[model samples]
Target chain A: MASTMLRTSALRSTIRATPTVASKRARLAGVSFVRGKATLPDLPYDYGALEPAINGKIMELHHSKHHNTYVTSYNQAIEKLQEAQQAQDIAGQIALKPLINFHGGGHINHTLFWENLAPKNQGGGEPPSGSLSKAIDGSFGSLDAMKQKFNTALAGIQGSGWAWLVQDTQTGSISIKTYANQDPVVGQFRPILGIDAWEHAYYLQYQNRKAEYFSAVWDVVNWKAAEKRFK
Target chain B: MACNLTPLISPQALEPHISAQIMTLHHTKHHQTYITNLNAALGKLSTAVSTSDITTQVALQPAIRFNAGGHINHSLFWLNLSPPSSPDAKSSAAPQLTSAINKKWGDMETFKSAFNTQLLGIQGSGWGWLVKEEGKNDLRIMTTKDQDPVVEAGLVPVFGVDMWEHAYYLQYNNVKADYVKEIWSVINWKVAEERFLGAQKNAFGMLKASM
Candidate 1:
């Protein structure tokens, strides 16, 4: 499914690149050019793949409805920003910043989150080895200790947000961090693993017993993805 | 000072409209955490003020606003809800407020429709409110994002509907419209009536009691 999406996007890019007289005429008319649209990336595994830990129904809604809305809204915000820039509307552009930050961050975070999960059969929950393992031990004492800290951080988020296992870019030391309301992990921090704590992430499956959802998600954490980011 | 705010209605009272499980967790776990964090933030804030640590004091603003707003909002929320079966839940229980709604939105049904629309329009975590413009009987519908309490000078948050997913997701799932629809049944119009007439001073009697 992911490959199919990539192929379709590639075709669209080719079509877009074939600039003709009409395209030039539209550009001359001050029509905003379509730079690119953010598309929802296909899930690495099937919806039902995460099963008992995170249900298929929840996965389907979170991806198709919630995540897709962010992508669509983000594209709209970018389009409006271009128009605002053309019109030199400073306040309009400034007002659009929050929308862009929110939806754009939602896209970035969810893209990472989907990659950071796998079915048990696909080596999900497999303990890290080598440098990543050593770093986890060096920073957090043990893998279990890191997981506990991450869970506690996840629980502390008062509203919609994410908890991340991040490596500081300068020192390469790992730490747990949380951000509220679709704010992305950026700057000097390299996000190694992120667990979404938004109620929509688990309310359908676990309801108010979010602590259980926190504990259960570890069974599907894709350590290989985290290992790659760690290095 | 530690907060010891308790629900005016029993946790199980608002069942069906809001489940007992949801109420229990929303009150005990969610609201309690906010109070705990708010108390801690206040402690640090006092020390920061005493030492004139401006940077530390400035940094604590978000924590104070978020947690204190959470505590205030939830404290009001519990009082503004009653069992669906209770007389307090009826629109007629709030005659003056109902007349005010009629003056503003034509009638009770129209007012409710407008309120529900505002509730549904909220993106992410936030609240929808039926507010009375300060020093006047005029009412309007408004929304606040992510633990922002209605603190605009003169504006009174007569009552609010929590649009946070935690408020309804356990029972309503993704069909938030259903939650919005059912919430009207449990809305304690009696309390809203008191708020509309009595103004902001009466709104935080619970918080003042804690003081």
Candidate 2:
């Protein structure tokens, strides 16, 4: 009977997710229009820049291996999509959704992620100033409060995914969000801050201590980069 | 409501080949989400099933099926592995289960080859299973695509191996063949034997009811 029986969260988040399929289509259309030209973007700094927080080995593997794979795969997916469109291969185009969602999300999210971090001496760890600062305080009470909420979203992600701080471009209100796998947020919201929670993002350095990785990433927050987008 | 995650058999208890990190994350993060999502789907299903709103039920079928299957499969999978018994541990600890496996597949080595072949044939995310048909000594090696419950197909699952990329991706990466080849060392024959006995009794009980 001891061998016979075995056993086993209700999660809530405050952020209002208003996903628009039209905008999602718009983004996919834009990518597919470019055909096979999707190239991996360079890191804003050296691989070792976020050292003691994000390790060089992880950055190298992540960008070169992981992110590059996405870029390459996305380009291929788009090329196939174009071919399908020309042939009017409806089934083939439909079959490409999972591939597009995953790799497209990967390429798009990592592009934003690179810009979302800075070297410590530059602006990493520095909180937002000017209008974006006012907006953060208005939306989440304070900068630290926003980071606390962001951390919660990051930690609560059940699997490989990303925790994002996204702003509705129409109203400029901030929202905390999480997406599973390589699902990228597009349309209606401009991504302000993103924390990659995929194990590959930190497993080389943090192992199962994801909390430590979440804490360390705050030091490298690119508030200035985020501010430019905010303004 | 009927589905839940099984307590981990512990990470290190099943490893020298399988690492503690892989087991821990697979249990806590991956499997936990499946149960949580299954609970959420069931919460919705209670309404749909009660109302007999076939539209909502149809819309919700994939989520319910996927998550419920995830919960069921992982529950069984947890009981399927244990620490290696031998010092060198070149083999498994399943003499009794091995006899059943031998009767079914002619030998343990042959059974593994057939089972692993079924595992490799999985195109994407899925699970490989050893199941027993009701009211008979019939044992089958089968594969379910994408978190599909074996019970949904009307068979009693005795052992299962999760083949979702998350299950072994961290340790095995894209080389899933290595994972399938190595997984046999840790299968808990004891649990399989218990389930096998349980299956026979349940089958016999069904026959008696019909009579």
Candidate 3:
């Protein structure tokens, strides 16, 4: 009975969120039920700010072209999903799930990625000083050790993916995890920092020597941002 | 079977079109890792089969498909390229395949334009292939996402272009159109012709030979 009620409410919310239905209801009641659209988040610093570690051209393309594509694709997927829901097309809705997950995850991951970096002069690469530092020390013995493990995890990724430093929400234990493609870190884990392992991330500057790119990225990692997420 | 197949053409042979640095790393590091993972997955699969572990067997399907497809695709990719200086690089080297392509798209230029459109249309990691349809002379352009090989019965993959960022990012950066344009110069038409005219088994015989 509880599950049935929960399922019915979920279906009710879906119908309420449909634009055509919502707009008609809005005209009657003067209340809007439309959800806000996802948009590309602005980067915290100038494109060239991370220079030498990551080039301005790579940064520009990564944000404007790559991340923007994800934003646009995710929005399109959401629109199609709404149309499918309105048509009561179960197969169409099922097929759109992966697209929504991939593009949506891409947007979410890249937004966090932009925040997880900073220019060298702006407190980037500085070791965490607060409880986050203690947590890292407790988990991996030292900052350097944790970084080494993180880099190793990044290296082991088979294809396009991300390596994340996450804290288990239940246990508050920090560890390294890798995800394939654009899968977001979810369910019991809080993502503190993420490093994109896709070739587009460093291929321009590092070429095939990805280990160099991996090591260089640490020089610009925004520990303060990570610390904020940790708390 | 051990995954020890070597490229028919030397790594540096495709330079200018594709740099030696990219080729060497693509072959040595990236493709090698796929081979290693495929072997490991096969070993685990054998164990699961022997132990009758249906759950483990089911779990291993994706790894097996991904790694095996990677090996197959890379193997075909290497053979599908030729040095620009080689006679095999010329479209004239593939009379039968060229006629088929001309039949399908009206001319070579139109065919390549259509193929490039499909190549660039791929989002994220993938491959664009020119495949010969089942039991017919009909040809089609198709794109497969992330290491997926063309393995449908009777459809022969004449050749494929890797559209992964690693395939061109070092040289072309985000200008993928340039990479797609340049790759035509090094395409091994001779190998493609053979795959087009030959049986499906012949197209995959390289895998059997390696085994």
Candidate 4:
């Protein structure tokens, strides 16, 4: 009798899920992003700020052309996803995950990338102070050693990717990780610093010499910003 | 069983063609996540299967299929690729593989042309595969949606390429064609030949057993 009862209820539950799923999709279709459309984030400093290390032309192109494209595409993809959900197009919703990850990741990474640098005069080259200092020394032996480790990772990227220094939010553990293309340091890691190894970043000034670019980038790294994230 | 992350082809090793940044990031981060996530999902699936939790099993379908396939596909993908046309992977190195490809697609250029076109047409994250079907000598070109391993379709994957934007977006940028075109330079044909030979034994053995 209990088995029969469970079977009947299971059948009913399966049937009920259809309309419930459809209505939920309808609700999602009408929804907008919590913050409205994603917009292009302004760089905290001017394109020319990083100067010889990054160069103004590369920064300008990266900001205007690349970052903005992600913002525009992300808006379009989300809107389409909403429409697909409203119409109960399950396949369409499934198809949009790549778009959401790619464009959304592009927007997120670039926003973080822009702020992680500063003009050398604005404490760009300065090492972390306070708890961040202690953490760095403990985690990576010393700051200079960490820089070497970080640069080696960045220099070895096989394609377009970023090297990140991240702090795991839960364990408070720090690690150096590399991500392909615009994929942000995902899941539990809180990004402290990222070095964009995309060719467009250093192609104009450094060309094929990524090692030189990595070496030069130290001069404009904003340890102050990284320290804030570390905490 | 848990799928482990495959070790990477070093940046210095694949230099001059594929950048150190692209290769390192793709293997270490991208491929590693798929394996990690697959193991996690499979753990949950084990519990669900033991209890005969149909609802839970249904809910876990996408995660299992996507991640499991990702692990399988990427593992083969890494071996199937090496610094293209290098001595180990030279076009002439594998006589049997060359003859098989020629028999199916007429010639090498035609096969590549057709393969890249099929790969480019995938609407989103997917894989283009050259598969040798079980018990069949002739191969087929197929596409699997988002980490769907070709093995699930009763075929043995010979050559597989990830069409995800991250695969080429760094080096080729918006020009996916160039990335697809250049990838041929680093393909490990030697591995494909070995996979082909091994798969033949499996296919024929299954046939003999059934008969």
The TM-scores of all predictions, comma-separated, are 0.77, 0.63, 0.73, 0.52
Q: How do the residues A1-231 of candidate 2 rate in per-residue lDDT, one tens digit apiece?
A: 121111000000101122354346547776433322566666767899999899998898888887888777876787688879878999999999888888878887887787778779767898889988998899899988988899998986644679888889788788899987777888888888888987778877876678999999999988876776674
Give the DockQ ranking, best first: 1, 3, 2, 4
lDDT of 2 by residue, B69-145 (tens): 67767777876676777432333444565677788889878988999999986644578998887655578998987
Query: Chain A TM-score for each candidate, in the given order?
Result: 0.87, 0.83, 0.86, 0.84
DockQ of 4: 0.03
Better of 1 and 2 by TM-score: 1
Write down the lDDT that model 2 would get. Answer: 0.74
Model 3 agreement with the true structure over A65-140: per-residue lDDT tens digits:
8888887888789878877877889899999988888888888788888877878887778888899999999999
Task: Using DockQ, give the best candidate's number.
Answer: 1
lDDT of 4 by residue, A40-70 (tens): 7656667898998988877887888878877
Fraction of the true interface contacts (Cα pairs closer than 8 Å across chains) found in each model? 0.44, 0.02, 0.29, 0.00
Model 4 scores a TM of 0.52
Where does model 1 sit among the CAPRI classes? acceptable
TM-score, prediction 2: 0.63
Candidate 1, pairs of clashing residues: none
Better of 1 and 3 by DockQ: 1
Model 2 chain B poorest 10 in a row by lDDT: B202-211
List DockQ for all candidates: 0.43, 0.13, 0.33, 0.03
* Residue A179 displacement in candidate 1 (angstroms): 1.1
